[model samples]
Target chain A: MKKQRFDYGYILTLLISLVVALLIGAGILALTGHNPLVAYRALLGGAFSNARHIGDMLEYAMVLCLCGLACDIGSRVGIFNVGGEGQLLLGAIFAAQIGVWLKALSPWLAIPAAALGAMIVGGFYAWIPGVLKVKLKVNEVITTIMLNTVAVFLCQFLAKGPWKNTNKNIVAGTGNLPGSFWLKKLVPGSNLSTAIIAAAVITFLVWYILQKTSKGYEMRLTGDNPRFAKYAGMKTERIVLITMVISGMMCGLVGMFRVYGAEHIYKSTVSNEYYFEGLMVAMIAQYAPLPTIVISLIFAILKIGAMGMETAAGVPKQLYLIIQTIVIFCMAAETGIRAAIARNRERRAAKQDVKARKEGGNEHA
Target chain B: MHNNIWSTIFDPGTFSQMLRSATPVALAALGGLMTEHAGIMNIGMDGMILMGAFVAAVGSYFCASAAMGILAAMLFGILIGLFFALFTVKLKSDEFIIGCALNTFALGVTAFLSREIFGLSGTSGYAVPSLPNVTIPLIDRIPFVGKVLSGHSIFVYVTWLLVFLMWLFVYRTPMGLWIRASGESPETLRTVGKNPERMKWIASILCGVFCGLAGAHLSLGYLNGSFVEGMSASRGYIAFACVIFAAANPPRAYIAALMFGFFDALGLRLQSYVSSDLTGTIPYLITIIMMVYVVVSRQKRRERLAKQQLQRLEP
Candidate 1:
């Protein structure tokens, strides 16, 4: 069988699907008595209108991109590490706990230490499912999901009990960590912090590792075919373990930044959408590291724009989620579109061959 | 150890509470087990349950009839199942992504619709009727087993009946064999002229009906006809775990669901003595620990077998 060419047919299908989704969205707007055009304009304007809004979008993009990279690695290796949320939460909890506990250390050391600590915890958390899957034939999907529930409960337990913000002056959350360990603000008016740079750097590094390293090649091979890799004498189980660990660590790093840059405390009020959004980003990019960054940023822009849409056009702010879901659905359905494209190409090839045979017959006559 | 604690465990009142608590999850697990048996991984059982609850509440509110509410819930459940099947089977979508999409979509759409239809209260069920508990005549007066088995909603009894039904369906039926064959050897089944997709669809629709009933039980029986955001919580996933632990056996899955229900009840009781926060974590913590233990022991067993095989090869 010939390889399917990356062609325009699939892109056309994606475009068509997106248009249909947008039309459905417009119908929803009309039913709600909101002007679709106005909402669309406001959403677009809000996403890019001001520097601060752009910064928020960037902030959202940065964390999303980082998590997307982690997810991309897992997906490429066929691991489907759906435990990104759990890993992120565990990382955040660890970072906050360490930051709050270690009062003696200087800010620089403490911050890095907290981040590193979270990475380790997150990595270990992921490794459990990976090990279970490899050694015992337990399904990772089930394990990761169970682990996510565990992580949510753990976070809830810690925030309300041991780490209880104690001040009682605010809503339930953990007590504030040292102020000095907070990420340095990158822009004067915006919440943009040095963490964005850190996240971007991490994304780049992931791209490099996947494209340049021998281990990355082996990991990809393991994802593509474990039996084949085993026949080639690769330690497939170890690769699975390591791949999950790295995926978990990346998620932890995203959590580390969220704690340090945006929230500045371990709060249970963290968004539940991050994990799904990260998965969406990775999947939309077809599990490519670099493209993940772009897709995540685009999603961030939509989120920021959603505020404008709500305020000016009277559209609900949750419109961003609908748009995100539509985009992902279209992207995920690309496989079927590609198959159609292949069939089309095959038919076209057969027609051309028939014409060539007819021309050869004419020449013989 | 104390008299009160002992009473809580062995008393008829406690047993009744446990059965009532276990009913919804057991019902949902029965549905999930059917899907798993047919080789379709369904993570959207929670979404189906949530929709069922909402629809049941809406139907009961307008019609003021419990039967109407149940019928409405089943219809909604079947529709959602079709929605899931469309993506997974027809569109060739990844089951995991589609499941996640369905979950998020249900969350948003239900919340959005509840606001529009029921007003902006974030929940509704004002003046809605609830399921009346059915007490067995003579059995209600009997001791432990009577309390454990007698007083429950019609749905609860139905759930218990389903355990037997599912067992029979899985073990004693030709269709059950086909489902197992589809999961284990779809190609073989296809060669014998069976449509595996059709089996999966049947499994999905059945799962949907059960999950819908689970939701109905939650809103109508447990919460007294109220629908709230994410009210199903992680019960669907917990039921899914029960399916795993029970190895998809109906009777075993029922037992596992009961174990979860027991912990849920214990957590509720503990809430009064300890911080409500710590108490709330109990169910989730138990689930995790249970899964981890199950996974670890299974691994150890495999390792031991591998070791034994190696030792035999050494001769």
Candidate 2:
């Protein structure tokens, strides 16, 4: 087996894309009459001004990391789980319900029950598409997309109806979990909590599974070539199903963390397309676990800091989203761009050779 | 009670609403069918529609002409199509990833530009010109049928003509054959001296144009020139589903979209009895079931074919 070489090309492409996207963002800001420099400065300052801001960024990163991992694991198993948002929502609702129902129990029992409940709900939700894909050959992407809309509506209905908080101040959500169920905050007045440590541990486990385990090897092999894996006596179907469930469970865990560590309640707006952003992170990282974590942190910074830019520089927070999409577009075009460059160089070299040979022939004549 | 429920669900108003709602989906699906036949999965139709809607609203707001607004939307749609082609066709990037990115881009840019141009309210507030309703003279004189068919935005009639034209183009035109061949066998198309890539680009452009019309109808006709955030609302995806369910056939895709429209209309009517939140899921739930039904029937057909082959071999 060949040792894996450090990918300088990918990093270079990523850096170039980042710069191009930022420049485009600046151009957009200029068009909108905002001072780009001041906006960017405000963005960076907002993300890193104090311990509280840093903590908030980290908290966002934790949620993004788990969501990215969810996507990464699905891609690794040759499944595109576009329903991560749906699974996360389902997991969140379950976690909140468990938290509320188990209010009388000790934190140890309540937390575990809540976490398990979320995992089961998310995993079960994912398993349907997985089975459909493996058994019926139904496209998971379409099913997942449809399921996402259904899940959103279901969650909203529950929040607005049966489980709605009766408190006049609370509008569209379940009541907050008991204090005992809350995760210990890492920074006072910030959303950061002990959940970050759990997230880190989960990330490490995902890395270990993907890089160090035989099962992970089989999964990757199946993803790369199902026919070859099947000929080699591996049950590719089971691997796909298991990987999908695990991915869904990770998403569910993110939902649990958001409830216990951040939001402390289940609301219709519990997640603001965090899974979609996380999917983008996973895509940019090429579906790798470690890079997903790194990219998640960067995305978290952009998200958190965008608010500051909005307040301080008077630029819309949506500007960062535009920047992020531009970056993705550039990244997607990286291979094509490199290929074009190589083609141009080859054409030039051929022309040079022709010219040199013609000159040599003239001299001989 | 049953008779009243049936009467409510099957009213002329329901049919009119169905036609109105189905118009955009049908248009998008027809465009999606073009890309589907050319072997490109253009999931970014939603984003394209969103961009078109925003641009059309803005254009009408400024020019005070629905025609100019549609023209602007079509132009912008072509640009978006080229952008999509540059990535998916020229750059050979993953179509799914590019499509998702386009969606995110559309959502962000539209939201940002709407805020910047229209202020924080993000609405043109009835200042924009809407597409006028057209009453077919003879049809308007008819009874129940007239009520269902007449007095719609001009695009509704235009969509009906386009659907028929699209069917003719796909089944009767050489360019359609080339596009189909491009998706099915690019090498064969190349052997015949036709550029499959160019056909793909043409399909992308056509898809963009149709989606542009769909968006124009949505904002100007359906909603009275009002642009809402994410108003496309996965209708593009539903359109793509329509294309798949109909096997990329234009008329069939329109029928599939009509099915969605019918359910959506029914959901609206059912809102009286059921909660609006639950009713909203009806269309999406039906789409999922339709997709599953398609897959299951296909599987059964394959199984029957295999059984037939086994019997022939034994004999």
Candidate 3:
């Protein structure tokens, strides 16, 4: 019932968990015959060594931030949209197609059209599971996972079939979007683009909607207790459906960004589980919007830096994943750890109280 | 042409492949059923199976014995199950979040170890030990039935046995009742002087063991002694689907997995006529449809019962 604020205890727990995870990572590095310090140095250095690397990190962070926001919105409506991967793929392909079709148009008109197309496709894809969850009482998790596989296969089919690039060298992707549709790169030879500004604006809008709007209140209420929300005369089903669409649209926007800003084309490999990474970011942030952004940036650094660590210290990049998961595990167990610590303290206090009382009784006698 | 397509799709070899493909999923589904009945929604079985498959291959590679690989996988499975229980049961953490983290962890750990142990490709180039196909003496001589039923990996028969044994365990045993009660009503289970948490723990561990076996079967028996990165290929989730489709009934879960295998094999066979990519989506599409059908039929049944009750009240 209390507002979910990060009090001192929570911050302390998070810091302790992070330190414990790093220690575990170091132990793993030692076991694997890699120097932990060397690996850590490489990881940090790689993430920030040059302007290009920093730009790449920011580019990755933008996508991850959007994905995290998508997941966060779904969670706020008590809908777990694990199909963000699928939705993003569909969105990306649609955006690519739309981009090429509107190549004759001006950038202002074409870009927005492409973006809207992606959002429609993504939101529509998500709406299927939303409807099933709300109307049929079917589990959304299984359906979304199943749909993800279907979406991936569908994208592969489209990329290889009707949308296939005509160039012999381009093996399995659509033709590149026209130059007019491209988002201007902020750094030369880097993926970071003006799309980052749009992403930031969208993030701010999402934060406002979640924190300052009545619809957001309804969504949170529905997530916290659907039965209570229904009793209070809220349209819980509609809220869930709308939230699912919005979540999906965000995923779609990520796909459009990938096409218009970074890859400039639709490929089956446009995403390397970016949605899952974002989902992890959301989970680590405990489904909060602002924290999701921060975690996404941190995760992006780890992901990009892992490659450097691999090249420098001969440690596997997956070491970061292990560390991330360990941190998540620690966070998941925080409540238990706190409860155990409290119980120990209570027991010690009770023992001291009895001892002091006995001492006083002896003195009185 | 139609007859040829039918013949290709319905051949004895297809059924044999179906059984082979169903083995791992059936095994994992059986494991998933235990946790499902114990009131734990374990979406992490995929990770458990992935870990098991990797560990099994590694164990087989080093030990030169399939049995040892299976043993190693089972031991790892127990540890994973305990880890899962430590969070879900003991710590009262969100099971879904923990499950997701476990999946990610398993993916990372397996990938990391495989690259370290087997080199950059994350595959063992040399042949590791694999489970042998068992030929039943008399059954092997039978014409069509033997072709469909015999000379498969030993896990195929083991899975069939497990399906039957699990049915008996859940429906016929006292502990089985307690496990069900733990899911259905944990407070009632507590009132009967049994710890529901213990039942959940047992179920979780058993699920882990079964999933471990599923992984062993996948790498050692199904894939011919090779460890492929990400080879588990979401079968754990398919197994979860089977468990849901079967409503946690072991025999029914086996049937559900068989259906998946049948569609998978059909899709493979149809690849010559249809695009392989399109064919690949068939099983997943069918899974979604099946889930919808289950919900719809249940809803209809509930509506019919309500209508019947209303008529009786009017009379």
Best by DockQ, which number? 2
Ten contiguous residues with the weakest lDDT in model 1 chain B: B116-125
* Candidate 3, superposed: residue stretches over 4 Å from native: A1-6, A339-365, B308-315
**Tens digits of per-residue lDDT for model 2, B26-108:** 99998899999999988899999999999999898899898899998999888888888888888888898998889889989
Better of 1 and 3 by DockQ: 3
Better of 1 and 3 by TM-score: 3
Per-residue lDDT of A269-316 in model 2, one digit per residue for the tens? 679888989988888888988778888898889988998888888788
Interface RMSD of each: 2.8, 1.2, 1.4
Each candidate's B-chain TM-score, in sequence, is 0.92, 0.97, 0.97
Clash pairs (backbone) in predicted model 3? none
State in Å the error of residue A343, model 3: 8.8
lDDT of 3 at B246: 92
lDDT of 3 by residue, A232-280 (tens): 9999999999899988998988999998888999986689778988888
Model 3: DockQ vs. true structure: 0.70
Model 2: residues with Cα > 4 Å off, grouped in runs:
A1-5, A340-365, B124-126, B305-315
